[model samples]
Target: MKVESAIAQRISRDALISILLYVAPIALMFTTFYLTGYKPWQGSNELPFKAPGFLEDVFRNLSSWGLAAIVLGVGVIEFAVGLYENKWTKNERTLDIVCFVVPKLVVKPFVAYFGLQLMPYLLPAAKNIFEWVPFWWAFLIIAVADDLTQYWYHRIHHQLPWLWRFHRTHHSAPYMGMAMAGRQNIIYTIFFSQTYLTVALTYLGLGYAALFVKVVKSLITTGAHSSIPWDKPFYEIKWLNPIGWVLERLISTPATHYAHHADTADDGIGNYKGNFGNMFFVWDLIFGTGIITRKYPTSFGIKHYQEEEWYAQFLWPVFKSKKEGSELAANGPMVGDAVPETETVTLKQETANVAVA
Candidate 1:
């Protein structure tokens, strides 16, 4: 009886600490983006947050509501699934908040500040190139370019060892949910947000290509992390195949990204190369990343990782393991001389042939 009471107390304390840590960053973000003059433009020529009619304008506007719906929906669905599936114990969520949320919150503001404020002044020529474009074209171009950059970076995360230790936390969800989607290391977020935002800001007026991808990435990521497996029908729809083939070619698909999260190394499935894609699978298709699984992975998460406490997941660079070969995201550990066999047959791509997604 005493032990049970003590355990409960500890869990409660941990959860409290985690809550404060997670809430701080998001609250700050809401304050920052909203307080800044980043409000929506009223003109028709302006992009992002268009109101269908005047009355629809009431209820704090559809755009803000839409964003809230997406975020809350993802969180509710993820935590709900986690609760039901027992895939993530309460402790796991602790690690997730720390590992995924805190770092991003801290990192994003500074990145946004620099990208929006400081960087532009340094590159006036880039600024001119940026300002010279119409919104729609800029939107389209930025959308394509950002995804193109992400494709390579995501692929490298899978291929690299030390980096995978952190990035792989994202894929560590045993089952999917909206929250699971955001579960990643601060280092991964920094690398991604920094690079993507840098490229993104270079083309700021690209309308919502910048915002669209962020929103789309949010939706798709939540959907991808969802245990519901929307990919089944997406793959089964005969008509969707052609359209999907086009979309998946240009962006990541649930099937492809899910395989990246598959539990077993050789899950007898699609590409487990740990290469994640979103918004554009074309990068993979163009860069030899296209995998024709058509099936979501049966098993998900690292093949040989131990479940670390949640704090390690977020505060990895800090308060996490750095021991060589530790089972918990152990990097640089010798996995014996046996190299795992890969069933994937790599086909070389010819640069001469251009495939548009």
Candidate 2:
């Protein structure tokens, strides 16, 4: 239980910058509404676009069952192509399976059911309030609100000390693929604010837009986490470089996101400390938290990873890791930032160091 680096001791100036980034979403939402001359409270809204009834059903399905099937389907393809190689051990498989299944089958449904039941009481007059907003505007607003909210949520966990372990399971994977795309700690999955935000938007009559946003976000993030590097074509093909420039900046690409999972940030291309964007890479760019090297890292996961038990990785603090000297163990350091090779200190010099990484 001897603590070396105390992450709680300090918050970097960059983290404070991240805090300021929260205003971006709020400003974007208001600006969009102002320019569009639309206000949900004014109540003279009109449906922006009318689609075939079948298309509505299709959108609904894609947002719901289609997303799960797509993740599983792409995952199977990744497995068959040896994208995981020998990295997905039994422990890794258990954690990935549980994370993928439990959240979709159990936690999300529970949250939706309860959230719907509580909505009437929570915001009695707010149900279907924004239903009249144009489809495109609603989509634009929801995209910024959900993604930016999640950007800060994600960035905070990495920069903050006490919250790192909750998100550490995600970084523990040694390789990238759909198999580990949904891998997350139970608590982290349970309290994810993005889910609640989406649900609230759906209840506020933006269900159609929310559904579309959800599908698009899921595909981008899933693809970003995939091992295939499908985006390379955009970078490699001379004709597509223009599109690639905008595309990579606009959304999470494998090149950018994989660098975020890299085991070491010392490499110019690897940036485990930044690249916190999920669906959109623009947030990283706006907040100065992203690096685009157009290169992939050689390795992934935490430098101090101890191969903690799957159960502990999935449900830590409730089930502590049995591995001694492990971060998830009953008594271990709150934030175990890896010491740089060049970092040296005399034993006599004692001071609290923040785990900035």
Pick the lDDT winner. 2
Give the per-residue lDDT digits (tens) of candidate 1, residues 259-329.
66776546556466634566656545544545767677777665445566566666575755544344344
| 10 residues in a row with least lDDT, candidate 2 | 1-10
Alpha carbon lDDT at 52, candidate 1: 58
Best by TM-score: 2
Q: Which ranges in model 2 have alpha carbons more than 4 Å from their true place?
A: 1-86, 336-357
TM-score of each: 0.64, 0.79
Query: How large is the C-alpha RMSD of every model relative to the true structure?
Result: 17.0, 6.8
Off by over 4 Å in 1: 1-45, 48-86, 103-106, 120-129, 194-204, 237-241, 265-267, 322-357
Q: Residues 206-269, candidate 2, lDDT per residue (tens digit)?
A: 7667767877888899889988899999999999999999999999999999999998878898
